[model samples]
Target: MGIIKLTNIRVYAYHGCLVEEGKIGSDYRVDVSVKANLQPSAGTDNLKDTVDYVHINRIVKEEMAIRSKLLEHVSKRILDRIFNEIPIAEEATVEVSKINPPIGGNVEMVTIEMTLHRHNHKQQSEL
Candidate 1:
């Protein structure tokens, strides 16, 4: 019924397609835009009012820190952890970016963005 947006959350981790890349960790930037009803939190203004952003970052960082074979998997894991750990978030769009990839291309960073909705499909239905 509403929207909550979180942007530019960065985490340093070691996950990549190559071996050395994993050995040498890099910065991972995350931008999460979640859509849900925040009426209760808005009105209550209590600690339990809405989804805790602090805890959300912790979940994302922990999930991203895991050594995954693919950025896609990492993104999905972070997304899943957020939805599972934070019940108030109905749906979330996670953009996971790798700073200065080791590919043979001219780019400062390579980003893998994944969008996932909350369980039961009611979250995306609002959008």
Candidate 2:
């Protein structure tokens, strides 16, 4: 098994609980860790044999572009999209961080992380 980690992917997107947040937008950071079998790709050095992180990153970017009301929703969407796109991934950990969240205090960021296993995800899809 091999892990593909994409960290601190910065994106400017409109996502928040408040109306102003969606209007002005804020910076967000996404981190994704994908676990998969790398034996085939390792031996063949073929892109198709492993998870294409470039495409994964692109999917993240595209999903981030869509405005959402909550971080949890966005994070789940990302995980779902990743699982749908990368069938070979055995498990995925996704984190979505909202930079400097709009609270009445000083906060660096508010983050939500979720992990999904392919088998369970597949079962969910089947139902």
Candidate 3:
């Protein structure tokens, strides 16, 4: 199986459990990985054999706007949304990180990283 990786996708939004965090928001970076067979794309030089990035961006933007109390839930929502929407993808993983969160400390950033895997018949998207 071949894999396509998308990294360092950035978004600024209101996503956090803290009151000020939600009100002010912050910068978030997301990384995603997709696993699927790339035989046709590799052989024919056609885009249809691979996943589309525009669709992925749309899903990420839509999900991030929904708001969440925790980064973990937001991360899960991203993974699930792509899995449910994209047909050719077999597995997906999402990692979300917040830079300079409103923690009032010297810490660089707080991160919520998760890797989710799905088989052909298993569909779990209810966020």
Best by lDDT: 2
Model 1: number of clashes? Answer: 0
Query: Residue 19 of model 1: what lDDT?
Result: 88
Work out how many backbone clashes candidate 3 has: 0
lDDT of 1 at 69: 74
lDDT, model 3: 0.80
| Candidate 1 segments whose C-alpha is farther than 4 A from its true place | 120-127
Stretches off by above 4 angstroms in model 3 are 120-127
- For all candidates, the clash counts are 0, 0, 0
Which 10-residue window of candidate 3 scores lowest in summed lDDT?
118-127
Instruction: Please say which candidate is ahead in TM-score: 1 or 3.
Output: 3
Per-candidate TM equals 0.86, 0.96, 0.87
- Model 3 RMSD in Å is 2.4
Candidate 2 local lDDT, 1-127, one digit each (tens): 9999999999999998799998999999999999999899999999999999998899899999999998888888888988888878999999999999889899999899999899888898889
**What would the per-residue lDDT of candidate 1 be over residues 33-94, giving only the tens digit for each residue?**
77767888789888686777788778777888788878898887777777777778878888
Model 2 — TM-score against the truth? 0.96
Q: Please give the distance, in angstroms, between residue 74's alpha carbon in candidate 2 and its true position after superposition.
A: 1.0
Q: 62-100 in candidate 3: lDDT tens per residue?
A: 777877989898888888777777777888878788888
